[model samples]
Target: MTENEPALDSLTALDSKAPPRRAAVIINPAKSGGPALQGAIFRLCETQGWAEPLWLETTVEDPGTGQARQALEAGVDVVIAAGGDGTVRCVAEVLAGTGTPMGLVPLGTGNLLARNLGVDITDPVSACYDAFNGSDQAIDVVKARLNHSDKEQVFLVMAGLGYDAAIMADTVDVLKDRMGWLAYVEAGIRKLPGKPVKAQISVDGGEPVRRRIRSVMIGNCGRIMGGVEIFPDARIDDGVLDLLVLAPRGRLGWLGVVAGIFGRNKNETESVEYFQGKSAEITLEHEQEFQLDGDHLGTGTHLAVTVEPDSLKIRMSI
Candidate 1:
């Protein structure tokens, strides 16, 4: 037996009469850890006397939704998203409300969903064990409609528009490959000087709140890069979406925005405004960069986002 691959002989022996359980791994092959993660998951399944997993590699044209659908069609026990937040989002887009629990291996640069789920980001063996042995915890999924498109996409962690999305769109791919999440810092610094766009935001179909905003971030869970808590009180199963509208006032207004985010009271600053509701509709004066779970999805003049609580069953130790 390989090191760290638990000895599950007793359990397997006891369940010998039962049908073998299997998993479907929807992975992004572009991720560097793809082969290693697959090997680890395979070893764990063998150790646990489970059937070999059905491996599906994501492509540039189809990230993960098609593969996840294929996994569902195969009737696997769980669908594992073995890549970054984008892959997680794609798998989630297909698994939500289907009652098929999803697992995570966190192989991408920004493993935001895995981080929030407290998965073992640094160890493939441990993450693979969790995928096969962990408990189910239902979480919220945010559905976003860009430019009022009938086709909706789901994000598990967070989504952003304007400056934050600009950073995602502008980050150097080579730098990101070498520097990881820190590449965002460099891109953010360069995009900090852009003009704020006029936005009309309506929360839960209430009165529209009009303002010029540098960026607007919507969150389902709190933590982000470097363990920063962007939405302090946000919960994955809260059934509500947390919105942060950033409008830095002057040359040094970003400092206030940082303070408001990290300070004791995030709601008490003019540079940052916080809102919570079931849904939000944001209309911008013009098309701006938009992103879902750190993957830039071109530009949009309008976005309608709503929270679907306890819609996604994520298998992870709580």
Candidate 2:
């Protein structure tokens, strides 16, 4: 079957005897469209016969993970994550391996995952319709354990250490909102002068590979915002992660790397290295800043990341 072919067996497995009448929407009110969007969601759910639609708002401090956990605990048939990539990642982390399907309602600056899944970022009503009628698809999730002496935490989607993370940490919130995806380019230019850090990385069962790198990105799915395929071959449902290493030698080399990334010729760039692996371990020379799904997570010395194959069920437009 083709990639777009709907799995008849999976659709038949869905309980069609009765339409799903209960749903929980975990929304980030701070995101764009706020109350108006939430109201629309309520209307959409009601239209779908979801009389008891539970609405949960994400707090500025707690994010959506806690809310998603609550939604799952409430036994809702579908859990809709209404926010950006960070919110989606948090909800996916909780819903993974639980046989609970996740629905996306993109409402952030960069809806990377939504674009990857062929989701309609605009038209919340249409998006919700797809959520209600779409078949379930199993997708891969990247689980990262950031070891900072005593503390550890898991990450989903994309994880970055060094240059990319530094750019994320430094990017001003106002600029991000105003400039959208262009903010990353401005931040990247500002971060180009920093010295590369030496690190030891082990891919799958391979021997430790040591190199001086400007940045390292581990991606479960290909592409960033604006359809830029960072890891062109990366698949969300595949049981592997794409590891991208950048070690530009000079200003011209860095531009070349950027060109390659945008041109979908990552392997052609001399300053960049790409690999696919089930797991990876990175031991930095010193503590380095990192970001998980665009959210900065301070500094860490040791990072261990693995791909959880088909761990999350997502409602996709067939």
Candidate 3:
């Protein structure tokens, strides 16, 4: 080969280099500034020398589960959920155990999973940047089956039964738009007077323990809306599910539950009890309100939850 000519070996090496990675952004077009966010992501991907992202818009009929499966089929490097908690949960349900990492760009009122992952909620551009270039961390995703149903739904944050779910059901959308997480306060107050349902809770297939409970919150992570650490010891990647049972006796019983949640001595009160296990089965006396990741799923009499350890790979800077 001539000295001035390009080396054949170097040319082959250049041609053999891998193609640019691409991302599928499953976004909720209903969110404010959705088009603007998509534009921002398009520009950022171009600047970062990556392939153009495949934009998927979520519809009323299908949130993200279908879109996520589509992304996986396309062999995208990353699947980014660019909406709220519901969208994140739907994408996560599909991506869990699939080996493809999921990214987050919080564009909703309560970015529960993003908040738990320490992703910045205020800045969408920074979030998109991290979605394009970030490290992956394996986290646990909990699967819940209601009313002995054959189908099991996955939740990344928390699943609620009874009063908590009632709060989710009663929360007003207009108030939520104006007040954000505080909108739940109105619902909570309205739900406080409900009767406790007798629950038979079995953890890890152990013998069932009966109790009068107002709510059963199974958490995969620690915090919730308004930065409340309901399960203080909970960890997303811990490979365990944290369960909180609320059983208030009287009008004054809620005070103790509040104290137990916020006070240093959390385990001191019976009104609020915490349990850790790999799986839990709860059978309520009646059909009570049920919710998954803050989205109410109507009423159910039974809920079985199991923790899938390190099943989801979440990509973020932190």
| Candidate 2, 32-53: lDDT as tens digits | 7878877787787777767657
Evaluate all candidate structures by whole-model CA lDDT and list the values in order: 0.91, 0.82, 0.92
Q: Against the hidden reference, what TM-scores do the models get?
A: 0.93, 0.89, 0.96
| Tens digit per residue, CA lDDT, model 1, 16-48 | 877789999988888887776778788889999
What is the overall TM-score of model 3 with all chains considered together? 0.96
Model 3 RMSD in angstroms: 1.8
Listed per model in order, the count of residue pairs whose N, CA or C atoms clash below 3 Å is 0, 0, 0
Pairs of residues clashing in candidate 1:
none
Model 2 CA lDDT for position 277: 93
Better model by lDDT: candidate 1 vs candidate 2: 1
Per-residue error at 254 for model 3, in Å? 0.7
Residues 151-173, model 3: lDDT tens digits: 99999999999999999989999
Give the clashing residue pairs of candidate 3, or none: none
In candidate 2, position 250 carries an lDDT of: 71
Between candidates 1 and 2, the one scoring higher on TM-score is: 1
Q: At residue 146, give the lDDT of candidate 2.
A: 84
Worst 10 residues of 2 by lDDT: 148-157
